[model samples]
Target: MHSIVFIGGGNMASCIIGGMIDQGFDPLTLGVSVPSEQSKERLSKAYNIAVTSNNNDAIANADIVVLAVKPQIMRNVVLALAPALPKNAVIVSVAAGITVESLQSWLGSPRAIIRAMPNTPSLVRTGATGLFANDQASQLQKATVSSIFEAVGYCCWVESEALINAVIAVSGSGPAYFFQILDIMQSVGQELGLPEREARKLASQTALGAAQMAINSDQSPSELRDQVTSPGGTTERALNTFRNEGLESIFRQAMNSALARAEEMSKDFSA
Candidate 1:
């Protein structure tokens, strides 16, 4: 059993802990360091794991220390735990915009580090995570980290950290974009005289089914969409309108904007 420690007991950390436990990881092998006594108690009660307000103690005792704190607090947390972190312990960071080099510098060593960006869907075990590991990470360390994420959802490895900004735009913030589409569908359904609750249910299930079909089918998304859209049919009508209004271009622009923001944040944190 791997001993994992989380430096922050926030929602993402809790989701990971829940995923680990569901995957048959012993809760006792997990530990969390949270600043709030109430948060610590909540986490301990929820996961039946050890918790403390002392970050150093958590890092010293674990084989893997996950830096789950916000980017703003990450450097200070790493610096504080650097002295106590056992040699060879792997550091996994979920803090957005914080680079591997910055983390290594704050730790005062070329530590084995894996930077991951996982979105809110991680709470439901349907997350998409993009991982980038530093040179110091061993094969075993990489495999272990991959397994942890795989248990929760899909995991993809990126060769360059620069590509992670694109990952953030696509997967990190993807769920919110889907949610907005769902909201619009729900509103349209209700406006068409469908009951509110039933409209919401249908819209949500339609979204879920379409997503699952895209994942499971061998056909590309465009091909699948064409399969549904008969020429001069209702679907074609809507598609035509969307195409005429440049929906695809709009989405491309939105994702590009998001990627630019992520790069800006990375620069800000690095500075």
Candidate 2:
């Protein structure tokens, strides 16, 4: 019996499985069940693990079953595997906008379930995950789930399911926001007549350095910004323009809107 079974062999699942392997887990101990033969072949070859198209076969001998499928497909997948899963198996779901209650209902009862939201950055092993578990999960089960997430990146627990939406806004959607800023910086540099390659290198390195500094320094981000913004400096001029245009307010509004949308999707799935 494999210790973990991943029902989807997509990017997120691949990242997690790869992380687990890198953390000294035996590849033969993990099983992946993908719908497409091509995906099965790819996952099996890439991870040197067993692969199957049958979800039931995948979960039949697994202790932890990770539902890594798309949200729209989760219900069907859970329904198909519910009858075959071990009575005491722990189900961990990584689908966005799907609640633990909905997952339990789909699986036929309130069982041991962990609802997790992990960001795209998990591919690089810098992802942030928010986890919420149902009351049926034991202390050891929760710790195992937390360890799995932490193996790929960082993991935090949320008290309320509502806060998971905020987690979606801040951490789940954060990488896209940062990429947009990088795009803007690259475009501005090109407008200033800098070569495209040079502009990209400078912009990317600057962003990386700033992020590392923020992570390592004891100072707040605002304080760091102030430190870089000397009177009459180029940074100060840009900072002044951003402040005048209410950039902070715009970011706050954007994140709030994302949170609302996540909540709406959750309601839709539950409905």
Candidate 1, residues 121-218, lDDT tens digits: the string is: 98999999999998989999899888888767899999988888889999999999999998999999999999999999999999889999999999
Note the clash tally of each candidate. Answer: 0, 0
For candidate 2, lDDT tens digit of each residue in 149-183? 98799899998878889899999999999999999
Which regions of candidate 2 deviate over 4 angstroms?
none
Error of 1 at 234 (Å): 0.8
Global CA lDDT computed for model 2: 0.90
Weakest 10 consecutive residues of candidate 1 by summed lDDT: 1-10
In candidate 2, which residue pairs clash? Answer: none
Off by over 4 Å in 1: none
Against the hidden true structure, what lDDT does model 1 obtain?
A: 0.89
In order of appearance, the predictions have TM-scores of 0.97, 0.96
Candidate 1 lands at a TM-score of: 0.97
